[model samples]
Target: MPNLELLAPLAAALLAAGLFAGLLAGLLGVGGGIIMVPVLYYVFGLLGVDEAVRMHMSVGTSLAAMIPTSIRSALAHRKKGAVDEVMFRRWLPGIALGVLAGVLTAAFVKGPVLMTVFAVFALLVAVYMAFGKDSWRVASELPGRLGQTIMAFLIAAVSVMMGIGGGTFTVPTLTLFGYPIHKAVGTAAAIGVLIAIPGAIGFILGGLGEPGRPWGSLGFANVVGVLALIPTTLLAAPWGVALAHRLERRWLRLAFAFFLAATGIKMALSLLGA
Candidate 1:
């Protein structure tokens, strides 16, 4: 067991992170993994986790937490009839396969390399969110079989690398293809569930036998983090869904963009050891 003195503060931090992550998931369809991964990295560092496995543990733990968070957010969206079940079904298989591939890759890749990739991708996502117009259309509707397979695989692979649910890419892709913003956000929440399940499992398998893991860890996923986060995330997610239904679309986009950009910058600065 961790020292009581240390564990108390860590629990508090995890709870706070969970609250914010849940809100982001419901409001932006982001699955909260983006926020959780970095937060976990810092927390694990404070606990003196080994540098070699810190990022891996963080990413894996984020994916595990997202399982429940995504489920809550998805159900909330489904209640509002915002989810597109058909699209989710169409994308599921490809995304699952991609996540498996990502797992294999992550098992061998070094931590710094993964962090750099995540930072760069996050920055690109921020740029697109900030400047990309809603009127942009890649197609009138979702692509056919070949295109769907390719895009879904790419989305899952990148999301796995970043320890994020697919929403960061999925919502934008859907919107670009002319889906309504609300519907896209809702659907993305559902997609998060798909990503989190396989993604978390992959991380667990990948991290098996790794040394210097925090106590109460199962593979790369930390039980302590998951336990601390899940309850708060479950409670907060519904509130965020409520807020999302009320917020204006433009304001939501701006807020999401700002958050992404800030996080991207923070990660980038870490690369420079700033």
Candidate 2:
């Protein structure tokens, strides 16, 4: 017997967030976890959920909501021949295992510790996106297949722990290894599916026996939020992928930089009581 009126505002928030998330996902190959995570943190705060559960819920919910959006966007990119299936096959195993480890770590970590880690990581990503080099193409690539495999492992591990789909690091890493921006983003989009599937499952498993969860939650995944968002995201993601094809490499890099900076500031502020 919840008040339907209150759900109106929550529904609106979810829709708006999902719309933006879809755009970001399609355009930049990001999973929108960075954006969704902080927003969910604040929203859950208002709902009086414990801070301990807030981050887990936010991360899990974002991963769940990202599934359809990523799928739609990936398909759009695939249609354009932008996705590198070979790269995806190389990275899948690592991303899957990494995401599981990440979810388990998040579930076990103390709340304050997790928040602090998240804040630091956010700041670093923002700074990297903002001031770091933007060559947009890596030449004289890293050694052999072995090097690439190691890189995949590291990227997956970090992405899972942070609840990101690995784009924040993946695109730049690829660029540094001689890949162009468009290919990097397209490949990253495809990799998102690999990350989300297992990450979502991990979240569900980790939260299954947790206590005092709100109704309408599926483990840590918020069913209400997911249902409200998936449709909007599915509809918007294709448009975003189309738009991504129109943007030049320079513009795309700048846009992603701005996004990372904004996400970082928002998270840092919340953590700092600002």
Candidate 3:
């Protein structure tokens, strides 16, 4: 039997993380997986989980947790007609291929290296979110098929390694290409569902039979973590969607940028032993 006593604290922390993750999913199209990875990693460490697989477990479990939240957020956004169907279709094939590659990358890359990359990337995106003008555009339209495939691949792959749902990359990339922020956020929410599904499956397969995982883990995903996070995340996500619709686009972007900057800085500081 699992030890409920030891699990209580982890459950508490997971619930809190879920709340934030859900809100961000709706508000900024981020699946909250980015934040959840670090939280799960720390709590798992305190639980005596093995260091070798701790990051893997964190990434996998976070991907699993994101499934429901992203779905919920997507549905809420769709109801408001914020989702851009044309862009979603154009982006789907590449997103699929990229998700597969990303899952594979996560299997081989070292955790610290991935974290550093994530931190640098987040900071860069944050800068754009904070200051990029509406007129800024790489082109008058999104790239042609080949270029889009590569960009989509990179977005999905990087997001998987970082335990995110690809929104962190997608939203800014879309906005940079002249898509409206609201449309970018909503479309990204739907795309997150795709990223999380395959990413979760890949992690589960990758971690099969691996030792030193937490109790109740199926591969790297912990049943307790998924369960504890889901309810609150489902509850909070709709609230965030409503609020995001109410807020001005500029304010929403600024708030999201601030949050990303803080998360990235905190991760970078961890590398310096801070």
Candidate 4:
């Protein structure tokens, strides 16, 4: 077990991160998994866990927390006339299988490599979302089935590599393709559940099979970390939704872009040790 003092800061970080993630979700209509994954990785690294297993715990724990958070956000969005159920249904199968594949693959990758990959993705996405043409379009031109399937596959592949829930990629992709931003956000939130449920299970099963690793971890997921994160995120998620309902979305997108840039820079620096 980690020292109580260590756990305190971690607990505080989780709470703050949850609230922050909620605000980002509600305000930007994002799934919050993008921010949560990197934060988990940073916090876990600070706790002195073995580098090799850090990415697993970070990705798994983020998915665990996201299960409840996404549900809360999705419901909130559904209430507001966002979240396209039709799109969600179409994407389920691809999302389900892809997430499982990502988690299983992560169980075997090296930590530095994972971090570097995450950094690269974050850096690219941040740049694109902040400056890309499709950053916030009101209409998409892609066929519904093809777009959802492609996104599901992309989300699963990226989540495993970067510890995200595919929101950063999904929301923008959907919006660019013609879905309303709010609908895209809500749909993205629903996808988090698909990614989290299977991913969390895979982490647990994988962790159990690893012979020697840091104590207090269940597979690649840390029991301690998951337990610490759940409540605060659940509570904050709805609050974020309420806030989202109140804010002007253009400003919110700007805020979301800024947050992504900050996270990307931090992750890049961590990988480069600068």
> In TM-score terms, which candidate is top?
1
Per-residue lDDT of 121 in model 2: 72
Q: CA lDDT of 218 in candidate 2?
A: 84
Query: Which pairs clash (backbone N, Cα, C closer than 3 Å) in model 3?
Result: none
For lDDT, the strongest prediction is 1
**Residue 200, model 4, lDDT:** 76
Q: In the order shown, what is each candidate's alpha-carbon RMSD? A: 1.7, 2.4, 2.3, 2.6
Residue 226 CA displacement from its true place in model 3, Å: 1.1
Runs off by more than 4 Å, candidate 2: 1-3, 136-139, 248-274
Candidate 2 residue pairs in backbone clash:
138-178
For model 1, how does the per-residue alpha-carbon lDDT over 1-274 read when each residue is reduced to its tens digit? 7777988898899999999889889988888888788889889988889988998999999999989889989999999999988888888888988888888888889888788878888888878877888789988887788788888899899899889998989988989888998999999999888889988999998888899899989999999999998988888888888988887657666776787788778878987899
Reference-based TM-score of each model = 0.93, 0.89, 0.89, 0.88
Can you write out model 3's per-residue Cα lDDT over 1-274, one digit (the tens) per residue?
A: 5567977877898899889888878887888887788788878877888877888888899999999999999998999899988778887888898888888787787667767877888788778879977677876677888887788888988898888999888887887787887888899999999899989999999889988898889987887788988888888899889887787668767876797799789879977889
Candidates 2 and 3: which is better by lDDT?
3
lDDT of each: 0.88, 0.74, 0.84, 0.72
Worst 10 residues of 3 by lDDT: 247-256
Worst 10 residues of 2 by lDDT: 134-143
What's the distance in Å from true for residue 248, model 1?
A: 1.7
* Preferred candidate (TM-score higher): 3 or 4: 3
User: Which lDDT value does model 1 have at 184?
Assistant: 95
* Candidate 1 collision pairs: none
Question: Candidate 2, residues 1-274: lDDT per residue as tens digits?
Answer: 3457777787789788878778778877776766677777767776667777777787778888888777777788888888888878877666766776677777788656556666677777766666666564456575466667777777766666566677767877887877766788788888887777788888888888687565688888888778877877787788778887786545655665676567667667766789
For residues 150-267, what per-residue lDDT tens digits would candidate 4 score against the true structure? 7688777777566566777777777777766667777777777777677777777777766434557777777677777777777777777776556656555566667777877886
